[model samples]
Target: MISFPFSKTPSVYLKGERLFLREPQWSDYRQWANLREKSRAFLTPWEPVWRDDELEKSSFRLRLRHYSEEARSGNAWSLFLFRRSDNVLLGGITLGNIRRGVAQSGQIGYWCGAPHAGQGYMFDALKLVIPFAFSELRLHRLEAACIPSNLRSVRLLEKAGFLLEGTLRSYLKINGLWQDHLLYSLIEGEEQRRGLSVKTTAV
Candidate 1:
């Protein structure tokens, strides 16, 4: 495990065996743009409609600003996953829409570059994140929703110890249409009960 100060804004850097997760940086614009551009077709079906300037540097700057505000306010933690061996950008994961007080929950969302899909990188990333959400963040629950047709996501969540909770009709607008989504959740003690071992350093 490695640790170091990240940024002035609230942020995290998580190190795993094969990869690491860190807040998106201004210097990452080119890599981010390249990955997203190449994976656009593969990802569009599951994501919101993209803007014409979605890959432009200005739009990326705006995204970073929004991410900064979310982190500063403790509303979310957005991180980009990178392969540690060669430092290649692999994907991104976020814990968003965090609720505190009695609820103490957050929603999890992620996207992987097309080239990296179905390669187990995300599974490793999720293993690292689940523990952080439950232990470091001290959250009671973490939730995720995916369209029923997205079997890959369904399997990833289940493999990460998230149980199928129920379904939400018209839950989110994806690819320009409202779609039904299967909801899944993992409680604080559930992962351990499911025999999950996650070890990562956060700083």
Candidate 2:
């Protein structure tokens, strides 16, 4: 069973007014695949082409191994975002590539279920996670990269108190093509002082 206020595993379930974040587990395979399959059309335009082995149990086994490694190294927090009221699987948010010796930072990456786009749930989700990253994990900064054309994600980061730092030319490979990304970052302990509070947006 999972415990709370604990390690990077299935510790406390983070709850917001509409959603909660939980650690991924074997039981989530079906729900995760369903949402991912349904979101393919919407996601494919921005994500890499799916490999034939992506959904196999063999792949999942590898994933579990990687998840364990990431957690043990304190280099990532991979979570499943779910609807609080009905427990629907919405999407996932990953805080990856964490560094601590000098640069205590991690990159935030996320995707929403097809049915949940254009809603502020992602932003609310970020709000809750950011504080936890800073306070609980003692992170110094968090960053996200968005395609220049992804106005939605860019706006979401801005609304969540991240500043547009710069752009990375051809920084990522998406849908089989190299894409540029606009970088956004927020330093720990600064958003509140700047009068920036997390706000909600609805579809």
Candidate 3:
């Protein structure tokens, strides 16, 4: 069964054709750890250096607690990607840094397991999440930043209708070093303009 820690929230699950976005559970620690470990080398260059206890159950519990607060407060939603066919945990996607009122926008970040890379799963996940960001979350814009050298990420964002906004010099620390990133943004209804099907249901 799908479990949402933030069960009181009206928007807890987002469903798509092949994958579903759901809240992460403490029981997912083993699968999450194994996938991250196998994808460490493939993921490190684009992500922060893993802490010594990065895969520990205690660390994951802390992470879940922090994000649970973020979700309930309408500040962010950090969801794990899972294949609906067999309920396999593929990776994660986060719509963070949410701003409301005058500036209705949020930034998105995502990753896929090494074995699942290049399989268009992230693309499908983005299709599901973007609509939720715009409709359920009532955000007007979504932003993403990626290392310039990470061509796959750049392509994924562009293919999903995000426009290249510009470059952010020394934008974020990745794998222990400051790295520049190319900024991308997608406005409300931009995906439709780009001709990508946005078929999803949020409940």
Q: How much does each candidate deviate from the true structure in C-alpha RMSD?
A: 1.9, 4.3, 2.4
Error of 2 at 150 (Å): 1.1
Error of 2 at 58 (Å): 2.9
lDDT of each: 0.92, 0.80, 0.88
* Residue-wise C-alpha lDDT for candidate 2, range 29-144, written one tens digit per residue: 88888888888888887777788887777787787778767866678878889888898899889889999889999999999989889878898788768877777788899999
> In model 1, what are the clashing residue pairs, if there are any?
none
Clashes of 2: 0
lDDT of 1 by residue, 120-173 (tens): 999999988888888888999999999999999999999988999899999999
Q: Specify the highest-TM-score model's number.
A: 1
lDDT of 1: 0.92
User: What ranking emerges by lDDT with the best candidate at the front?
Assistant: 1, 3, 2
Q: How high is each candidate's TM-score?
A: 0.95, 0.88, 0.93
The most accurate candidate by lDDT is 1
Better-scoring candidate (lDDT), 1 or 3: 1
Clashes of each: 0, 0, 0
